[model samples]
Target chain A: MELFHLVLRNLLARPVRSFLTLLGVVIATTSMVLFLSFGEGLRRSLAQELSRVGPAIQIVPEGMEGLGFSGYPEITPEEYRRAVAAGKDLGVKRITPTLFLVRGGFDPQTSFFFQGLPEGVAPDLLYPGIKPQAGRLLPSEEGAIVGAKVAKRSQLALGNPLRLSPRVELRVEGILEESGGLADNLIFVPLKPLQEVLGTENYTALLVALNPGQKAEEVARALEARLPGLKAQTTGDVMRFAERALRISDLVRFGISLVALVVGGLLVANTVMMSVYERTREFGVMRALGAKRGFIFRLVVLEALLLASFGGLLGLALGSAVSQAINLYTLGQVGLALSAVTFRLSLFALLVALGLGLSAGLLPAYHASRIPVVEALGRV
Target chain B: MMGAVRAENLGKRYRQGEKEVVALEGFTFAFPQGSTAVVGPSGSGKTTLLNLLAGFDLPTEGGVYLGEVALHRLSEDERAEVRLRHMGFVFQQWNLIPTLTAWENVAFPLFLAGLPPRARKERALDLLEKVGVLERAHHLPSRLSGGEQQRVALARALALDPPILFADEPTGNLDAESREQVASLLFHAGQERILVLVTHDLELAARAERILYLKGGRLVRQEVPGPSR
Candidate 1:
């Protein structure tokens, strides 16, 4: 018989203990995979959305310069004018002044991300490839174009009136075709109505698109130098900042997952140690029958590795299944696939499991190999 | 030095709470190449002598030699290697690995000796057949009767054709009829090899060409049992 078969038979001799140990590893791996997948998913989604944005640079209030800037618009009309005038001298495209407002609750029906641009600015000029799925873009200041996800969630169609306040209401002129990007969750309207609603004379940011042959980096540098109080951020700058933030969060997530890995490792150690202790007498018999100490050590350690391997594979399968289910739910809720199980993560989980097996097995295997033959044989 | 087994001033001591107990002391013997039985009552160092001579335990003050290699001076790992290459053992408890089938138990020594699977199986089957347990080769140790397990163990000890064999109360767990059957096979396996038996049965000891009586951790007498088989 092969040595592998011998180790297998030993583990199979008592099925309950092995299964319980396996279950502990599975739970640990599942939780780890599930938690880390969020970081992977957020990175992927942000990259996709960042690539789709039309503007090359955004000049905003200094602190509010990255993706998903949601604070009240603090940049005044004067600051926006200064940024636009400075960009006009450069090889720049049209500078669009936009205001952003968030009015909502946790419920999808009540939640709204409102982007207010100047009257008659074509939606495609600001968000490329945007077109009406149900109706046309805003034809007048009295009308609005709702994004695909928002429209579907609110069950709105063309000509349905959306209320921003008790006094400000506009007819839904169109519903945008789904692009599965950030714009899919916004409601686009004319700037005048939203400013009147906010009761403030301020602009959120000045969106700067560059003409052909103008590098955004140089233009953004010029814009920042021209306007000292305000900050000009390029798309690449925003993406890098977001990625850094995600990386820090990733570290925190992995630190939490490590807790589970440690517990799983302890379970493996306990199970293998008990097996070594209970089977010492058999080990002595084996030694008497001419089996070497190295062979006995390998037997015990191999058992641990087998258990860990099975647990890691099963955990990966289950974690992937769960991530797919989560993506399905998040896709329906926000038009975003928010959980990912990348190939690298699967490899990492398996390596961690094998590492756990080796570390857990060493002490027990040593004890088993060191046991005196006489004392072991002396046991009944 | 070759083919000769000898002990020189062999002694062993154990610590029990603040006192020392002598398990075996001042043992000297040149075991012949055939069969020899060491017999004594309980707590008379029968098993202790077997342990020292088999190199399973170290003697405190003396040494044992298999040819030129000193068993007592060798490290535990080295002693284990020697046992694997040259010594075969049968314990009183019929210590067949409970997880292995009858044939697998018999094949274990061959497997340890690095024999290929087919060759190990062939030799193990031949030995099992010789011991009259061939039909039960696939049954696990727990599923077999006590007599059958001991027979498989005997088959295992002879698997590698070792030059030295140690049987520690091999028939201690068997009934009278099964004892006779195991004793017959064991003696047949002893021919031309150094076979050492530690037993309490004088009847079984009579089958050996020589017997040494042990008492109070010392060898008291040696006699020629006169071939009664």
Candidate 2:
């Protein structure tokens, strides 16, 4: 017990050095936690948005890749109507086809994904209801449901007529709630007018709702077999892609955190080595008083453990605080919030930090124990 | 009476660079237990002789027996165990752990012995009171004056009540007054335990049971103090 106290006192002798080393570990750990959290939050947000629509499959025409960015696809009216007809024949409950505009279809404008729902259907029936800041949406052929972002950016109001390219005009019927999703920038329109403006009689992509007892996979296979030169996708495909992307993103984040942890471990090792070197005479004194080599080994290792454990705890607290603050800010601004931004104690990260600290103590402890007792006492 | 320390043709040599330097060669001595001092100027092998008897350094040739144990034959670890379990040492620097309090320093041997905390602390306090440093028990070695540190060291040497205590110039760094105080404490402890002291101070040597004078790594003279009985 006295020896332990002596070891602690020796470490605490140079207050500034010990504190600075601990602070270094804290900062490094905090950065690692924050970096991983940001990646997790983004991935989660993407997944949430994709899962909102009730398992609808979207089919975009080939060579119309930019339509996803700014709803403009080069599909002839015949092909669009054919795809919709094929979707209807596959026992689908509904086939809603629409046009999408990109970059708000004008210069210095944001892009929106505009899906045209069938007339007389409740707008909320097919998609999640929009929390309107100003007006309600009418379920009519001429009525339009505008994304909250588009309303805010274009400064359009309810009952206002907004003109699109090729002489298509839309009446704003309702505004949506801020969902922090792809829909935030989207503007819905009537299918006929949108197709007329693009000089097409067909939809750019078909949104298929399968009949009851019909799985999405079965319906997708049916639609693909029926339509030539057209592809069918289910919600599961999009989900799988999203999952793969998230896994890759997580791997990258994990790699970065690992590098930082290794660097922190090296810093700990260097600090312990320097401390042992500086306290050679002190170790000698203990050894001359009949302290065994194992005693010196444990003392130095314990000192390292003390320093690193202190740093680990401080880092965890700081990182958790920063992550929670970010989560709060995100919830306030984006409506969707992250539950945890840092590695929760539920994870194994805290244990990993302790293991790293112990590993760093190995070489320095060995060196301390091997110092000759005779040489130490000679100085005495 | 049996000698507290007996060396038989003890020889110690070290490889310095390319040549073997004999620190002590073919030396033999035995003195009655109590307070015996070995006095010599620097390089007279005073410390070398002490190291051999304390079972710290191995003799290159020949042997030393401390309390019937052939110390030179023990392994390094065994020697260290013997030191912890049976011997106590004091040094010129007073060699107190700078961070520990006076009482804690006195308790160090018991800690090495793995004694229970309560027993160790009790023994430490008792030894501190015997050394007349109980008031300074909680003060660190750095906080104490040189004389106080040496007194604490004396208490530490008596912590385990070892039969033999070896000190190399216990008061070498103290002023005259502090030196007297430290030497008196050490000599007082010798009444019950054998105290083998190595020093260059002839005045301090005169108070011992017998004094052995060394020159050029060899014992050149022997003197019995107190009018030679």
Candidate 3:
């Protein structure tokens, strides 16, 4: 206890030196924490966006290319049945058959035709639910769902009826929940109706769900073997390709975060070095008084920890406030966007901050510990 | 029997370029359990001898026995342990730690020895009272006068209640009256320890149990007093 007060008093005696050193440590730790937090957030966002795509296995027709966006595949009903039977043989579950088309607009005003989904196969049932803005989604064969933003722009409302052709009429059921994602521009209808409009009684693709712990690759290989000329792709494989694209975006964000952490380390190192110099005499005295080399090492490191912990606590509070402010501004005040950028201090960021603090002090503290006691005493 | 220091042919040397300057050459002495002074002119190796006795410097040859242990054979840490448990030092310059208050400085050795806070405070206060500098206990060394700082240094040297006290120059930096006061305090401070002082002041040395005058790093004169000078 007596020694504790003595060490504390020695540091406190030179408040300016101590405070400046502490400030440096804090800046470094804060930057490290913020960067790590950003990386974590980006990783989560990327994963979330990837999962937004439909199930792993998208069993398209033989030699059917450019299934996404081009919106057409020439698979017969017999081919779709064959693929479903092959997937069933491979023990795949929930094989949702979908009829895809790229015909002209369901409305004469738009050039884009709605994508078609199988009966009882809800687009909402895809990996990420296609949430509806207002009314419930389409029931079996009665109504149609439109992306909320598209519906709003098109001035369409629930219960409104639309005529795609002289022969087909469908009631607007619901506006899909805006996923600032790809689902935002989509239109969905019953698979049978869409297949009929495309002049076919067969689906262009089949989406399958696997049992937990079953490898998608194994299932897809089995399905491919069971049905010749049919291509079987898992949700993971599709998501992987999309994830690669997302990784590029994430890498840029992560790079910025990495730079921030390095800046933080430099800040801490500079401050702690200055602190060690200022406490030279005090350290010398401790060494002279029979304090072992390790004691001085611990003391200097403790100083760094103290400074970093203070900064980390402050940064956490500040980060939380910043996140809350963003939430308020984007969600409430401005109300111009679908979602606001939120700040989250994940456990990973907290641990990274702790690591930064510890490492930042290590070299400087070691140097402080090794300073010759005699030279320090003479100088003082 | 209870002598504070016992030495047998203690020697120390330093090398400057190719010249080996002998600081102390096989000097044999004992400081009995009472006050004693070493009076010698400047560059007489008074400080070096004090350093050797205080366990701050190692002997190149021969040995210094503080109480029962041979200090020359001990490791640096072992030497520090010996100093903490059995010895106290009052440097000629009164090298007080600048950051600590007078009382904190006085209690430094006790803290080093891991004494509890309350006990350290009580003992430091008690010693300050004996040294008559209790009122200046809270003042830092820089705030205290030279005499006061020396007195506090003296009080600190005695805090562990060591059996031996080593003062390189107890009154070398003080004014006449303050020197006399510090000298008197150094001699009469209530303790059953031996006090060894290095001084160039002959009158001050005359007050010790014995005065050894050093010339050319050798003790050339040994003066025994019949009464206090």
* Every candidate's CA RMSD: 2.3, 4.7, 6.5
Clashing pairs in 3: A28-A264, A56-A234, A56-A235, A57-A235, A77-A202, A131-A177
TM-score to native of every candidate shown: 0.94, 0.81, 0.74
Whichever of 1 and 2 has more DockQ, that candidate is 1
CA displacement after TM-score superposition, residue A160 of candidate 1 (Å):
1.5
Question: Between the candidate structures 1 and 3, which one is better when assessed by DockQ?
Answer: 1
Report how closely model 1 matches the true complex, as a DockQ value. Answer: 0.67
Itemize residue pairs with steric clashes in candidate 2: A70-A101, A70-A102, A71-A100, A71-A101, A71-A102, A103-A111, A131-A177
User: Model 2, A346: alpha-carbon shift in Å?
Assistant: 7.5
Looking at model 1, residue B97 earns an lDDT score of: 91
Question: Model 2, stretches more than 4 Å misplaced?
Answer: A2-4, A56-123, A126-134, A137-139, A148-156, A160-166, A178-186, A190-240, A250-267, A332-339, A342-349, B1-10, B27-33, B62-78, B218-229
Estimate the TM-score for candidate 3: 0.74
Residue-level lDDT tens digits of model 3 in B48-156: 7876786666778788886677888887667767777777767666778787898888888887788988999999999998888999989889999999989998888
Lowest-sum lDDT 10-residue window in model 2 chain A: A62-71
Worst 10 residues of 2 chain B by lDDT: B1-10
**Per-residue alpha-carbon lDDT of model 1 for B120-223, expressed as tens digits?**
99999999999999999999999998899899999998888888889989999999888999999888888778999999999888898899999999999999
- Residue-level lDDT of model 3, residues A1-380, one tens digit each, is 34445446666877886676556545554454444444344445445555676666777655553234454556566776776677665667767776655545555235434667766666777636677787776544857887765576677888887676667777888878766654565667887666656566766677777767777789888887877777777656655655565567556755676666566666667767876787677666555555556777777677666656666666665655554454455333212222222345445455556677789889998898777655655521
Best candidate, TM-score-wise? 1
- Candidate whose lDDT is highest: 1
